[model samples]
Target: MTSESSPTIGLPAGDDVFPVLPLRDIVVFPHMIVPLFVGREKSIRALEEVMRADKQILLATQQNPSEDEPTPESIFTVGTLASVLQLLKLPDGTVKVLVEGVSRAEILRYTANENYYEAHARRIADNVGDQVEVEALARSVVAEFENYVKLNKKISPEVVGAVTQLDDYSKVADTVASHLAIKIPEKQAILALPTVVERLERVLGMMESEISVLQVEKRIRSRVKRQMEKTQREYYLNEQMKAIQKELGDSEDGKDELAELEEKINKTKLSKEAREKAQNELKKLRQMSPMSAEATVVRNYLDWLLGIPWGKKSKVRNDLNYAQEVLDADHFGLEKVKDRIVEYLAVQSRASKIRGPILCLVGPPGVGKTSLGKSIAKATGREFVRMSLGGVRDEAEIRGHRRTYIGSMPGKVIQSMRKAKKSNPLFLLDEIDKLGMDFRGDPSSALLEVLDPEQNQSFNDHYLEVDYDLSSVMFVTTANTLNIPPPLMDRMEIIRIAGYTEDEKSDTSRLYLVPNILMEHALEAKEFSVDDEALKTVIRRYTREAGVRNLERELATLARKSVKELILAKKKSIKVSPKNLEDFLG
Candidate 1:
C-alpha cells in the first residue's frame, strides 16, 4: 500500500507488459531492495530481457514452493513490479540481480514466448484516505511497532527512524509491514490490499500474535538463566564449606579410618618383611589426598593386610583315635583313603614347622576323594574350602590377577585363608587334572608354588605383591586321572580312589545314600524303607558307574515315586522291593 505520489521509476504505465519471474515462498513488497539468484531458464531469461529493456520485471510468488515447474495457475495473479538495480553474471550460468520492488501490479493477461515469460500487468496505486485520519493512524502504527521491536531484540532500532521519516501514511504502513515477522502468505495478503488502512490493520493483528510468542520464549530463556546461576552459586558455596571444614580439621575424609587400620596392623604379630611392606604402604596412603583414586587403592590394599590372620592357627586334635573315628563315621569304604588322612593328622600334631606333603587323591568321579578332604577338616579341627580347577586357563586364577587390572583379586589360596579367618585350613583343589591352558596362561604351572611345601612357605601372588605364608595350609587335591603335569605331581603324595565293587556300592547305598534320600523327600524312615535286595538290584541293573553318585540318584528316584504312590493310594506305609521297584521308578 505505497503512495502513488512517489515516483515508480522503471515501472510500465497502465497495462504495459514486462518479463515475469516466479518467486518461491518470498513476498517482495514495494520499497524493498533484495538480491536474488536467478537459476531457472525462464527466470534467468526474464532477468536478461528486463536488463535489456527498462530493467523492469513482474515478480510473482508460487502457491506451492515444492513444485519444480509452476504453471500460471500455481502463482498468484497479484505481484510486484521490480526494477533491476545491479546485474552480475555468475560462473554457473546463473545471473545474480539486485532488484527493488517499485509498486504492486495485477496480471491482466500473459504473453506466450519461448525465450522468457511475458505478462501484461497493470500498476496498482494506494487508495488515499482523509489527511487527519491517515496522520492519526500512522502515529498508532509507529507506537505498536516500537512495542514489537522491544519484544524482538533482533529487529534493528533504525526501523523506528525510517518509519518516522516517511511523510506518506501508505508508505509508512507498507514499510513496517514488510519488516514485520510473519508467514509469507500473510505478508502477501497485506501487499495485495488496495488501501493503507486495511494493510495496517492486518499487520497490527499479526504483530500482536508475534509479540505473544516472543514474550513466552523470552520468559523461558530468562528462567533457565536464573536457574543456572542459582546452581553455580550453590556449587561454589558447598566447595567453600568443604575447604573451611578441612582447614578446621573437622572432616573425617578417610584420615581417621586410615589411622585405625594402621593401629590394628601394628598390634598384630606379622613377619618382619610383611610388617615393613604394610608400614610402607601406610606411609604412601598418608601422603595422598583422601579423595584421589590412588588413595582408594592404598586403602583397599591396607584392608587386605588387616584382614589376614597374621599369627592365629587352628587347634589341631593330637588324638589319633578321635581322628580315625571321625573318618569312619563320615564316609564308608575307602579305608585306605581314610587311613592316609589320619596318618597325616597324627604327623601334623607331632611336628612344629613341618613341611607336609600335598595329598592328591586321583580317582574316578564321586568316589569319596572330596569327602575325604572334609573328613580331614573335621579330624584336624580346621575349616574346609573347595576350589574347582576345571577349565581354568588363566594363571591369574591360580596366582592372582595383577592389581593394575580391573576387578583384580587374590588367588584361591589367599581367598580361602581370608575366609577361614585362620592361618591353616584344609583347602581341597577339586578336579586338578582337568585344568586347561590357553593364551591367558597355564593354571597348572602356577599351582606348582602353591602345592610345593618348600616354595609355598612364602607364596607370592601377583595381586598381593607380597609373600603369603602357605606352609600351614593343608592342601588336598582331587582328580579323576593320574595324567597331570610332572612338576605338579612331584609335590603331591598321590593316593588312588578306585571304582567301587558291587558289594561296596550295596553297603554305601544302605548306610549313606538311603537315609539321605529319605531326608530329601521329607519322609519318615518308619513310613518308607529300602531293603538290601532292592539296593543290589539298583546297583546291578539301573546304575553302572565307578562311584556311588549314580546309585544315589537311583535311590532318590525310587523314593520319590514310592512317596507319590503312598499319597495317592492313601496308604499308611510302603516297602521298596526289587519286583515292585519298576512300578515306583517308572
Candidate 2:
C-alpha cells in the first residue's frame, strides 16, 4: 500500500535499538507531544536508560492496561518512537518526562535485560499515495477537523490552526489523528496505516461520526434546558401569586389546615405504623389541591385518625365490692353472668394488662341480655358503646370500607370507639346472631378479628389502613340464640342466661322494675304502690314470660292508669292489691 516514501527519522546505522516503555490507557502518535508520569520500576528504569543515551524510547501500549508488569507478548508490536524532551525527578520516587512522538515503529525483537526492557525496532517510513488524491483528501480532512474542533470543546481551535499549516499530507494526517478523542485501538489502527490517503480517510470518517453524535447531544441538552426553564418559570409565577395574595390579606387556609393536622398527628399517641401512615397521608394531602374531592377525603381520614381515643382509657374500677354492687343493683338474678363479669374485673385488677374476654350473652329477647352489657360497663368503669349487628350483611359494616370507595369511613367498631372516647370500652355488639350474609359480605366474618383476643390487638380497619388495638376493649355480644358462625363462636366465651324464674322475676319487679316505672310516670312512691301479691298476680295472669320485661310493661300500665285516676278521678292515692289488680289491668 506504499507509494513514493518520505525520508524516515535518523536511527543507528546497524540496528534501531531503543529502551521499551510500556504505556497504559494511551497510544502515542507521531507529531503528538504528551507528558507522562512514570511510576513502575521497569518503566522508570527504561526512561532513565533512554535519557542516559540518545534520548529516544520505544513507547508501546499494553494490550491490558491493568497489567502492572507487561511482557513482550502482552505489548503491541507497532509503537511510536518518542524523544525524551525533558525529565524531572519528583520526591514521590516517580519521574515526570515530556515526550514528543517522532515516528511509527515496529519492534523486531526484545533483548534480555536485567534492569529494564530493551528492544530492537525499525522506523516505518510514511508513504505519500497518488499525489492528487492525497492532496485532495488532506484538504477535505482539514475542513472536517475544523468542524470537529468547533463542535468538540475539549480540542482547542489552535490545534485546527496548526493542522492547516502542514503541507506534507502525511504530517497533516498524523497531526489530526493525534488530536482525535478516539480509543487507543482506533488510534493505533490509524498510526499503523502505511499510506497518507488511508490514514486521512479514517481520521475524516471518525471526525464526522463524532460531529453527528455531538450535534444530537447538543439538541438533547437544549431541550432539557428549555423544560427546566419552563418549570422554573411556573414556580416563580406561583411564588409571585402567593406573595400578591399575602399582600392583599388573603391567607392560605389550606396551609393552616395542614398545619393543624400535623400538630394533631404529633400530639396524638399513635403506634409506629399508624403514625407513619398518618404522616404519609399528610404529605399526600399537602401535595393535593384543597378544593379537590381527594383532598377532602384525605382530610376526613386525618380527622378520623386523630379523633380515635389513642392511648386514652378509662381507669378500670378495680373494687370487686363496688363492681358486685353495681351489677346486683342493675339486674336481678342471672347470677352466672354477674359472677363472670366480677371474675373478669378481678383478673383485670390483679394483672398489669389482660385481653378482655369476648363474652357472648345468649338467651331469649326479653332476658336482659342487652341490659347486662351496660351493667358490665358501669361495673368495670368503662365507657359503653353498642352497635347493632342486626341485619348487617356487608363486611364493611364491621371492618369498614376501603378508602378507594366514595365517602368511605371507619367501621362501626371504630366509630363506637370514637364515640366512647376510650381505647378500653365495653363494646356491645347487640343482636349479633341477626348478622346476615349477602353479596355485600358476611359481617360475622369480619367480627372474628374484632373478637379474637390474639388478633384483636392489631385489628386492621380497611378505611384506616392501619392496625388499631382492640385487646383492651371488653367486647360483649348479645344474641337471641347461638346461631353464630362456629369460627366466630369459637373466639367468645358463651354465657347463657336461661330466662329468669318466677321468683327472680318477682324480685326484679319489686326491687328494680316497679321503682323505675313509677319514677318514669312522674309518680311519687307514696302516691302509687303495687303490693307483692298484686305484682305476682300481674306477672302470672297478664304477662307470663321467663324474663321480667313483660312484667315491667304490665306494671307501667298500672302506673299509667293510677296517674289517670289521680288526674281525672281526683283520687288521693291509688294502692293496687290483688283484689283491685283487675281494675288497673282492665
Task: Give the candidate number with the greatest lDDT.
Answer: 2
RMSD to truth, every model: 25.1, 10.4
- Cα lDDT for residue 188, candidate 1: 82
Q: Alpha carbon lDDT of residue 46, candidate 1?
A: 86
Total backbone collisions for each predicted model: 0, 0
lDDT of 2 by residue, 381-475 (tens): 89999999999989998888999988889999999999999999989999988999999888888888888888889999999999999888888
State TM-scores per candidate: 0.56, 0.59
Candidate 1 structure, TM-score to reference: 0.56
Q: Write the per-residue lDDT of candidate 1 for residues 1-586, one digit (tens) a residue.
A: 2334433333354888888898987888888899988789988888877877765799999888887788878888889988899999999998888999888899888888867778888998766555556566777888888888988887899988888788667677788888888887888888888777777777777877888898898999999999999989977875775576588664684657877978888798877877888899887776566767887877887787678778789886678898899888877778877787777777878888658778899999878888888888888888888899888888988788788976777877777788888888888999989889999988888888888888888899887788888888888999999879988888888889887889988888778888888898999988888788887888888888899898888888888877887899898888988878878665
